[model samples]
Target: MRLDQMSGAKLEQDGSSWQAYAEQPLTFQFSFGDLQTNQDKIAVFVRSVENGQPEAWVQASDGEYQLTLAQPGHYTFEFKARDQAFNYSPVTAVDVTAIPVPAMISVPLLGEVEVRIFQLLVLFGSLAIFGFGYVSFEIVQHRRRIVAAVERGYNPYISGEPVRRVDMFFGRHDLLRRIVSTLHNNSIMIHGERRIGKTTLLYQLANALQEVEDEEFWFVSVYIDLEGTTEEEFFHLLMDEIAQTVRELPELAPEQIEILNGLLNLHLAENQYTDREFNRDLRQIIHILEEYGAVQHRGCQVRLILLMDEMDTLSRFNHLIQQQLRRIFMRDFAATLGAVVAGIEISKEWERVESPWFNLFNEIAMAPFSTDEAIQLLTEPVRGYYMFEPDALDFIVEHSDGRPYRLQQYALEAVNQMLHHKRRVITLADVLVAHELIQLSGQQPKGSWGEDAARGELGVPQTPAPAT
Candidate 1:
């Protein structure tokens, strides 16, 4: 006998329900009749898409189930359901309307949490992009400005950049006066190490004597460097200077010009005519200068200041060559020309010539700037355009060994750090940073504190963030 079966289903909101149908395939077939309500509907039937053995028979049976309408769509449930006699139900179909309910989101906390997390990520991501762009722009602009300024040769430390003056002056009063008096009768040797500003000091001495109006001294200063110079080139350059000086002097008549000129060329030229010929030329140039002074006829003192920088270069030659050059200065040129020979402590070869008249030359040593001088060098003339804090000036001077090169290097680097780091008021910490960068780059910055001392000396204050 055929088992006649019926199945029903329902859905609840306020515990209300809707009834649905179950099917029996062994009996009559059911059709999807027209419904009246405007709601979504679904029909579920079980059928194995593949035909096989008993596994296919189980898959073809419609299983026992409940109606679970989640959304407004059609769904099909395919499974097996066995009856009491262990006979599986045949594939069946049922259709019902599911009244659409407003979706009440179940996870209120989780939904809100996801939205908040998304908002935070977007906010932080935007901030990161903006911050990176701003920093990059600043770096580019700063580099551009630095390149432009360097091209213009604008030094930030000192204001009023002057043209490269051949005659740069320094300050020394009584010492210059005594040097001038000595140079009038003697050729002095200026002794100093490199970068001690001896060349500048000599220029100042020359300027001082030149500025003396009431003194009847006609000062003619000639500066030369013997470094990389041959004896021929050395004397040749000196002759050019002396000839130009004689040509420009108003005290000497034009009629005397050729006599002096001829005399100079004769002595200044290659004297293959032997040592006697070379000495004759040297003595002729010296005699002409003395004659020019004597011809002034009004008791005029024609003083010639011959300033030789890097006199140590003469040592590169044989001792005899250096001795020959010294003979001219010690004997003949000593009477008419005031000579300032500048070199380091090792430049003794210039004075080692066997001439007792070397006693007439005074040896002046150039030392590094004093503390007060270094301070003045750092602060003055740069007061308005730039400034240093009270302790900042002292800190730089103390650490710079009173060396001008290092003083400027430290100050310029400190300024760079302050600008680069966007710090308004420069501190000792900035100095330390600049120092370390210079050291790491293999630059031995003067007065540089070691790492341990720097860490101990410049203790920066840490700022705490505000409590949220």
Candidate 2:
């Protein structure tokens, strides 16, 4: 007898007594031969030992048999072949050892509960690995993009300082036009809260005065910052600024500048310079300017406009000192000398009916930017370098309450957020991030957003935006 075509079993040795190792279920084919009888007359009988079942000789007419070893044990099968005359051949036996599958296999000997726990652990572990890999990839890509945006240098907002560049200034068109049209004959007073662009407007007015093309009047604008001036040094500082400004005029010759300097030095000396002396020296300076304008500008009159900033300090002086200033503007020099004073508020002393400054000049109140102005301010500064989504622009405008300073602060932080995320188009989510950062640092705006507080600290540089 020969065993062949075995599956799920590996034969250890080849002989009449065969030993094999297998994992159930195992199957094999057998064949028997007799010299005196035909192949069909042959019969094979099999019995098992120590297989956890009843042992008996079972006649197997077929040439194939199968064994299912449900338990781990040593199993033996004895086989005998019988010829047609009932003659029996020598017995052949095969031994097999059934063993447990590897623990790494899909199914193990663990109970049903343990099997479910193992399956759940595998599923959760796979999810965690996938999640970790996905997050790592996103972080790497974000870092690469930030590096690229930084290399491009795309910041275009200003904060924490006054705007100095003319192109960077926005809005105030009607106010500027009105101020210029009446600046020749009328003195103007500009009053507004702090950080409302008062200083910037004064600088703009000076620049605008230089560009005005007047046929009859030569406009010479002199800027005087009265931030720390006292009543004692008032006349001295005024003469000094006048002399410095007049010396820079291109039309004045060297000898003419020397004469103007000499006149200014007379009142700027250590002596107690009174308003009368100031008036005298200013009269002489105006005569010099008028003569120069006559000869060089075809007889145009000389109009000297003083753009004084930080005038709030003047309120600390006594009413008499304020009267002296009003007297100087109310004299004959009123025709040739004009004043544009800017401050946070007009002194209460000036509101009195009989006060010297009660009706001295035309007052223009400063206001926050309008919606259209805010849009222009946000977009024009970064027209080509970056862009703002419509909702982002609306978010800034609505939260900032159309205040130029707050608008700049919001824009500064929002652009920083965009740079951090390496984005060119600013979105509402970026604005929300900026708001959260500002709130965390206790720099959020007041009035519209919350209680009254001092202005926020926004430390962005004041560089001019790139030209469109």
Candidate 3:
């Protein structure tokens, strides 16, 4: 029997044999032409052309045979018809060729172009995820390092208050020297805008005078904060500060202490102490010191320096009270008692030619720190432990405008940032972060008097209020 019909793959007659070809794995149905008696049973077999080994014949069902080719190859299919008596006809062969379709060309939902695009997307997506994870991990590690550094005391900058420690005090050397030299003969008025380190300078001056080894004069430096004092209580407060300071003098004899206490008790009243009483009490104290200096150290004259801070309060007093204060310094006490008074401005009243305070003091305007001084202030305290990058240092100096208080504030915040990141080096980025923090805390750096003066926001200059 010969094949009569075939389906699924294109079949063509090549000479006497039938041929078929398929792009994918080949499968087809075929039927043989035979008489009814011969067609009672049919069988089919398959074999590879390369191997030439035939498979056992299997009976076809219902006069039709189905064939499947799973691999790409040349194959032959043989069909036969068998009678009930068991006689079989000659084999009818068909040659078939199966060619595989490339996997990329036939992929579901992804053609050749789509498949390549998908592969690229996956590659780039994986890389982006890895990069993001790495950056996030580094940020976390940096934060941990900063926290650890801060706990270990990496920060050493001071802000918001006067520097009480002498070790942490920096710069102002020339200013200090000038003030000391001026105090030998004349009183000084240190005038500056707020937060310009007026009080800090006062503290330093106190320490410096206490350590003086002068041959001609013995210095008795008394610091008095004249904030919130009424005019009537001024003399009482002055005497009270003088008594406290003298009591702490290491060179004072027991009898000298007793003499001072006696004078204080006699002239410092519980209420209504007068300027006369203050003058009398100061005169006796100086005399006592002079006597002690003469006997103990051979003829050194004693001088008392009143380091009066927040002297702007004096401006609020009536002109009579102001004149009374000026007269005290202008009269008999001028030689033995000198004053280094720090204030915002010496009230416009003192600027008058006829005013008692006019020409009384050698005024020294307390300007902002010089660039060199600011550098010393910023770096000296944290020197050996942490450092600032050059750009960061410049940023602070430029932004702070050499104002000591602003410099400290900026440095303090920068250290805080360094501590947070556990970095030993302060960068410009760190200072910028510190600046934002300061502004967030409502302490924006307003620069110093020059800027303020330009804006007309600078009223008469004033010392910073005392730290609460």
Each model's lDDT comes to 0.52, 0.75, 0.71
**Model 1: per-residue lDDT, tens digit, 1-468?**
111232433332233222222221222223221133211222323432312211222322122333344444333333433443444435443323344443333344455344556667669999999999999998887665444433332223421121123222222344567777766566677777566566656656656666654355666676665667775565565566666656676777665676665654445454333344445554665555667767653466666677777777755656566566667666655555677877785336434545333454677766667887776666643333345677787777877676665666666667666655554445677777767766676653432222222222222211110000
> Per-residue lDDT for 238 in model 1?
59
The CA root-mean-square deviation of candidate 1, after full C-alpha superposition on the true structure, stands at 28.4
Stretches > 4 Å off in candidate 2: 1-152, 264-271, 347-349, 443-462, 465-468
TM-score of each: 0.51, 0.62, 0.61
Please give, for residues 1-468, the per-residue lDDT of candidate 3 as tens digits.
Answer: 656666655555667555554453334455554466644454444334534767776666664566555555667777666666666777777776555533353445654544566677779999999999999998887665444444553444445567656666777778888889878889888888888888988998998887788788878899999999988788888888987887776688778878886775455454668777777787778777777778765767788899999998887877787777778777778778899998987745567897768888888888877888888888876654568899998998998887887787788778767766767888999899888877787774332323222322222112322121
- Alpha-carbon deviation at 63 in model 3, angstroms: 99
Which scores greater on lDDT, model 1 or model 2?
A: 2
After superposition of all CA atoms, the RMSD between model 2 and the true structure is 26.5
RMSD values for the candidates in order, in angstroms, are 28.4, 26.5, 28.1
lDDT-wise, the better of 2 and 3 is: 2
Taking the tens digit of each residue's C-alpha lDDT, what string does model 2 give over 1-468?
776566665444445344454454667678889878998888888888875664988987578888776666777777888988889988877777666543342545554344556778889999999999999997886655444434444455655566667888887778888999998789999988777888888888888988888877879999999998888888778888987888787778777777786774564553577677787788878877877887777767888999988888887777787888887888767788899998887745466797668988798889988999888988887664568999999998998777777787777778777766767788888888777766777763321212112212222222544211
Choose the strongest candidate by lDDT: 2
